[model samples]
Target: MVNRVATYPYTTSMIAENMRLQVKYSEINTQISSGLKSQNYKGISSDTQYLLSVESAVDRLEAYNTNTNIVLANVNTMYEALGQIEDMANSMLTAVTAALGGGQVPTAVTANQASNALDETQSVLNMKIGNRYVFAGTNIDTPPVDLTDPAWVPQTSPSVVNSSYYQGNSTITSVQSSESHVINYGVLASDPAFEQLFRAYNLVLNNSGSITELTEASGLIRSAIDGIANVRSNLSINAKSMEDQIYQNEQDKVYLKELTSNIKETDIPSASVQITEIQTQMEAAYSSSVRILNLNLHDYL
Candidate 1:
């Protein structure tokens, strides 16, 4: 009988190789199933800070998007209200023009129309969105205009007219459109355009028996209409700017998400191939281990 002194070493080598193959197989299998390079930052230690920075940028852009949406809502609402006020001004202008052409003073009909327009304009300027008044500037909770306030005395001259009816402050609202851009987009009830409108309407209401005053009111209404048009133009520009920013934010978010995926997610097809290769290696190792274990000096003899 021959003594096989190297049999133990061969068996030990095979056992060690099998253990390595088993561990590799399990790792690849888990990787394939989970579809992530690593579940935690520690798994992708080198990219942890970069990933956090990208995610933070995405969060900031999301915040800007949310804020811009609110500003756009307020701007659009103000635009619509201004349109209604423009219509009211045109109606009052028409009434005043008729009185002027007929060589007569403004009657009760013109005065009542002026009064109704004043009331309606007050309601429009005091418009609120989600409990905050749109035209109130920084005084978001307070009504911006109150023509019915007894303390709001009417001005007699267009040159001296101001937003006496405005109860809001001069603080302008601003929005962060993006990382590099901030937009000052607030329109207060005290804006000169609104002031002109109120002046024209009040002129008609307070001087219904005076032809000269009615003619002056007609010109004032025309100026107010032009001023309101300019305000609408500026607001429309702001709306467009915010809309463009929102679109850019959406596209940026998509790019950031793709970056996140690249940093954290595994390539499924590549992982599958690796798992198949490991499985083959494991099978071969198991077979070799069995052969080593079954080795006998008698069989060789």
Candidate 2:
């Protein structure tokens, strides 16, 4: 009897090769459709640790950007409030100085002006940003200044002058601008300038038509105006600092995003070329597999 070699090995090898080609075709299709080499970390296991680290860094940068935006908004609001207060204080000073220079007594118009200024100043001090008072320091829930009660004295006496009008503490508010940097940007309602302004306006509005009282009030208003000017200067410094921090944070975010994209984003052109090559290979493989499956020894003879 002649020994015959088994043909099973050849058939099994062809089938296995065809299966592998099918799997490769499927993978290429997925890459083309999704525009990504790997959908999950496991797909790119070799670079998984590096990719995760880049992603984490990007997330941290994004978080810093978000915090910087919030801080900028809050700072802008505070700057506006401070600016308005400064303008109002200057106007009050102008009015008081004019009246005192003209030797005029406390007129109704002047008193009304003083009262309006006081009301506006108090309102500004009590201003809120989304239910949180900006001037309230760490005590953000409550208004920084409260003069709504009848018993709240608005006077120039030693007791009233020395009294604390701020409902919040002296704690300054701060924000993290970077991993190693923080910015303190807090102003209190009970600042000495604001107190003097309130006292001057109250005294002038409640005066009994005395020129001496008006003159004294004028002097106090001038002092308050000067004090407010100093406060504005300080605020400008803080605003500049905030602007610088925002710029730096934005630049860092841009760099981090680019770095992350380099690590994870797919090269579309390169992937498209690979898809074409794989498609051709798959077609050739399928034709070869068909020929092999249809092979017959009689046809060969």
Which regions of candidate 1 are displaced past 4 Å? 1-14, 103-106, 148-151, 157-159, 297-301
Inter-residue clash pairs, candidate 1: none
Model 2 RMSD vs true structure: 4.1
Model 1: per-residue Cα lDDT over 1-301, one tens digit each: 2226756676677778888888877776777778888878998899999999999999999999999998898889889988999998898888888877775644888889889998998898889888989788889989999876776676564436656678889998889989998887888889887887787778878887677677778888899899989989989998999999899999999999999999988888988888888888888888877766666767868
Show how many residue pairs clash in every candidate, following the order shown: 0, 0
Total backbone collisions, model 2: 0
Could you tell me every candidate's TM-score relative to the true structure?
0.90, 0.77
Pairs in clash, predicted candidate 2: none
Best by TM-score: 1
Give the poorly placed runs of model 2, Cα more than 4 Å off.
1-11, 107-112, 148-163, 205-216, 240-244, 279-301
| lDDT of predicted model 2 | 0.75
